[model samples]
Target: MSDLLRLATAGDVDDGKSTLVGRLLYDTKSVLADQLDAVTADSALSTPDLALLVDGLRSEREQGITIDVAYRYFATPRRSFVLADTPGHVQYTRNTVTGASTAQLAILLVDARKGIRGQTRRHAAVLALLGVRHLVLAVNKIDLVGYDESTFTVMAKQFAAHAAGLGYPRDAVTAIPISALRGDNVVDRGGRTSWYTGPTLLEHLESVHTAPDPDQTPLRFPVQYVIRPRSAGCPDYRGYAGQVAAGVVRCGDEVAVLPSGLRTTVAGIDTPDGRLVEAPAGQSVTLLLEHDLDVSRGDMITAADAPPALTDEFDATLCWLGDRPLRRGTRLLVKHGTRTIPAIAQELLVRLDEQALSLCGQPGELVLNDIGLVRLRTAEHVPIDDYDTSRATGSFIVIDPADGSTLAAGLVGADLPIQ
Candidate 1:
């Protein structure tokens, strides 16, 4: 099992994501004494407002809402955690995407009173598109609904069905009742509901397995830098420095430099500690090739036998995030891996209707927070993969060249059904 777990909390506004995170931090004894003291002193209530611990922004605290992705780190004896508390408002759905982009799991909260809302379904669809494998449906504020067990059960079944329709397996979704404010079933299984006999939120987080082993996937190493330091100990050291995005790389493995399709053998793997005989996915190392090639940043090094396709055109699912509307012929930059290329929105196929949980037939333009299917044409052929096959190689960002701001988050070859 991996020692670190990356997760995110998301839902509608006032869903208590911050409070849940703060409770996790507090109950796990992860907060510093001075930090606790400050929050305690700042609170007007008898007890410190736990939400203040995560709602760090003055605007968020003042408005009593989360507007950005707030990341928190804490640990228990069993494992460490990095949780992103994402904003829930419809306009800030982009932040939720940013927060959950790399998360292996997501805690999708629902008010026991509201049941399943449109934004909830939309967020669930976006999580599916992002390929987040594990999901926890946290039916929060059960106290508001008089701690009705049937209400929780009905919501869980409804969400489970929706998640299933979105391609999540039965075992991938787990539902738990929680009250972030009261600290029930968060870190501990409180006595409020003896009718429920499931693990606490923290217990589930600690035990749940997530994501397939990256080492089992094909090798994908995008060269971030080329190292050729001329030193006394190593006068002729030439290596490609990058993080192994997927699969295992061994010393003798034959690798292919992408776009150029130049083949070479892995001469060795070097790190700051020393040379390594083999390096697996997620490890950053300097790769020594048998033959020196014109490798640079944006070029990918992959297993020679299973190289990704080089293409100038591909279909993508885009989450439109720009303040201005997006339409066909909108010239933008597609930042894939480390490569940036000029691209145009060739066609806007359809937009996702969050209310109906279906695709809009002929949406000509996409506004902020509108997710749609688009055909992108790049200026040059770039190495890309299917998102379901390799997230590291298949994801790209659409950026506005004028202001150098990100306009959209894209997934290559993923046209997920909203339903």
Candidate 2:
């Protein structure tokens, strides 16, 4: 199997995010001939409109803006890619958060002429808060600015400082000057940016470590479904089915079920491909335990030595995506992994000021697209780990009780009360 890398792009509107994505696809010859023909026929200009490759929505073409997160998949000789083209409008910040939540690396675009804007800063802060450790500040549209080295230098320093202030390590952040429109430093190094001698955007993406190896993390497998075969051919078959959230598990490994504090040994690990000696994170498999201890969907199975905390109340940080303001005592359903439990917005904590990167004095409620620290109380005990420890077990979403609309994306222990 080929190595896969997941990444997302974020920046302010008109920062050429869609165009950059289009250029990557076009330059890499990932676009089909018919798709290119359609774009060419649709374009009013002499040249084909590359943005049309990704801006698939008719509304997007009509308005000339990206409103939803568009995902594209392609591969090169070295690696395969799953790229998310996120919207840049401040109103669509929720989309940006959704796109970057699972991204191992993010390419944050900035208009070479406009340095880092408020929305850029907000996106950067959100990426860092979501635990994305690798960042590429792609300073795009260099052609419009005369390809000046000083321009790139100044903007690079400013963004580096902002990323550092937001708690991102300087070494983890890379600033690349490019013109996504002209394809400079995107797929190849163009002559215009001779002064900027750095790896191209593609180079950094191919080389950056996606995330900590799953085998190095603790085991966290949230049981999704219980499998029990009643047929006479396998009358006694009982297994727990789910995707391994983190770490590795093997037959005969001692495991513990969370919330119930029951312990069992792994009797077997099975898949359609047949029995497996071991399974790693991201693999979907069924596990048979030595003793059935009432395991069900939503219960977590973890290595005995490193079980997650089972708690009903904890402080969490959330990116409020609800239309209605989120105030204290708001009741909702918290969906963690495969488990859905009644929960209440126990308290309204501090809200993060995107510009200042500081907490605003206690707010009575969080409005749309507001990133705030809040306390949540669940109806039953749920197993969880800190967002930093394991993204799989540490993140959750709040659903509106009345309509089931997703309201917020939450990270456990994202923000602790000021000391």
Candidate 3:
């Protein structure tokens, strides 16, 4: 409860995911009566259409389940939360990945009556690969299963086995028995599951901390825009504006500006409201240097001691999300932070084996939602770090210059040279 938490709910269809979220919002007083009334009518009684609690779209209301990722915000007296309620259908699996991408904690729901399912495994793999540190397995619909201790214990063990296969640390997984429909063990310790001793779903969520300072590996700030103050009061103001990709940056620190390889010292750091002595990852502050340099929007600002290498060749993992198959010689635009470069898919090394949890030697082409290791060649040099070290600088997205839709998310590889 000390800091804000970001979490996503994922599971198979009809697992009471929407209901659980609705329960959280309702018990926390985050939902209004008018909305509750509409849900009641939609359900034809007190047993409201719980899916409507999250699938706010009218079309989704007609269908009675989520089709796209639905975002909801709620706050308790102790902590604030941003919840991403992802769809359960297989076709909308991408929605789960999209939701889990930014989540620090993943709430994976299972039907107490049904136990664990394949969708659970798939979602768990994505969460693990994306570096989600905290995972909560919410076994919903416990009341339907008569609040049986065996039911919960069995499902928890089954889930733990599969999660272990995914390479998630054993201590990272926590399972809680819940009845989303009856509001049992959601925000409060409901009486139905009194035999089970564990914190409520909300309690676990409030305690999980997932603030990642990936920028701590090194100071790397990709300039999004160059601000030139031609205003009357500050006509001489020239600065670069962007979020720090990694590391802490302070005024007077020796810094390097790429790709011209110019060295300079930080004269000042300023935000729109005022000047600052330092800035770190997640801060969108502007930087003013001691000397005027030819830094532009695509340039990178990095720490002098350890900086990302400017390179045109690299190995990366690409999860293809487009309709077209990615093969060698395919041209795409790689966008890392604010830098975009024309890149070619040199090779598709191995197709991810989700079932075996191993990479295969050969695959024709990566299809939609397929994750694979890949080799790429860029037209211009872009400084980057491995995704594990600096998420801000290490990640990139491939785009089709033809239509501009996002195709794949990339992570820097060990093969890339460090400057």
Candidate 4:
């Protein structure tokens, strides 16, 4: 199987994110004949509206703006891709977080004519906070600027400086000049950018190494379901089923059940294909314990020597998504992995001035699309890792109890004082 690459596109509104995504699909021949025909018929110009390949919503098509996250799947002979085309509107910034949270890389577009804007900085800051390590500063619409190398050079330098100020390593960022509409350097090199010698966008996407080896991290397995078979074939079957959040699990490895602090050994690891001696991260398998001592859903099975910290309260950075403002003492549901617990917004610590990459004075409340640091108090102790350590165990969502609407996305330990 070809290695899978998960990436997301982000930028200010009308910066050609959707066009870039559509161009990638079209140039790769991922779009069907019927879809291309429909897009061509809908185009105002003689050429087909490539953006229609990704902007599937009627509202998006009519407004010519993407409102929600649109995911596209395509594969090359060398690699497979899961691309998230996120909205560029400030109000829809929360959707960008949703799209980028799982991505290993982010492609941040900047219009060659307009240069870097406030929204561009805002999106970059959010991506950095979400722990996106690899960044591509795509200086798009180069054709509009007469494909000038100097224009690309200036914009690329400014973005690199800003990204460095946000704590991203200089080597972690790559700047490319492209025209998503004209298909320059997106999939096939249009050869207009002869002055630039960097690899094409598709080349970088195919070759970049982003996947972390599972064996290097500590184990984190949150039990999603406790399987108790009642069938005659397996009357005494008791298995814990969940995707390994991190690290590896072997048949005889010692494990600890979190919050309960019970120790056990893995008796067997079973998958739909049958029993296995071990399993790694990203695999969903059932584990049989040597001694069952009351394990349930929401409980975590971790490496005995490297268990996550259990805490009832912790500081977190939040991206407020609710229409209503987030204030102190507001009750909400904190959904971390498979566990949902009642939690209170204890205090609003500080708000991020995204443009400046600094903190604003402590805010009394966080309004819609606000990024801020807040302290939360949960009703029970929850196992959590630092956001920088493990994305799966350190992230959570704040949901409204009344209507079940998601209010915020939280990253644990994101608010730690800069050292």
Best by lDDT: 4
Off by over 4 Å in 2: 209-214, 416-419
Deviation in angstroms for 85 in model 1?
A: 1.2
Model 3 bad stretches (over 4 Å): 33-43, 47-50, 209-215, 414-419
Give RMSD (Å) of candidate 2 vs. truth: 2.2
**Alpha-carbon lDDT, every model:** 0.90, 0.90, 0.83, 0.91
TM-scores, each model vs. reference: 0.93, 0.94, 0.91, 0.94
On residues 110-160, what C-alpha lDDT tens digit does candidate 1 reach at each position?
999999988898899889889888999999999888788999999999999
lDDT of 2: 0.90
lDDT of 3 by residue, 1-419 (tens): 45688889999887878878888888898888899888788775557766678978888777778888989999987788899999888767777878887888999998888878777876776777777788899998888888899999999998887778777678889999988877788888989777888889888887765665543487888898999977799988999999987788899999999888889999999997899999877899999989999999988999888888789998887767788889888999999888889999988787766655666765778887777788899999989888777767888989998999888877777221101
lDDT of each residue in 1-419, candidate 4, tens digit only: 38988999999989999999999999989999998999999989899888888899999999999999999999899999999999999889889999999898999999999999998988888888887889999999999999999999999999998998888888899999999999999988878889989989999999898776555678899999999988999988999999999889999999999889999999999999999999988999999999968999999999999999999999999989999999999999999988999999999999987777777767989998778999999999999998878888989999999999999999998852221
| lDDT pick, better of 2 and 4 | 4
lDDT for 167 (candidate 2): 79
lDDT: which is higher, 2 or 3? 2
TM-score of 1: 0.93
Ranking by TM-score: 2, 4, 1, 3
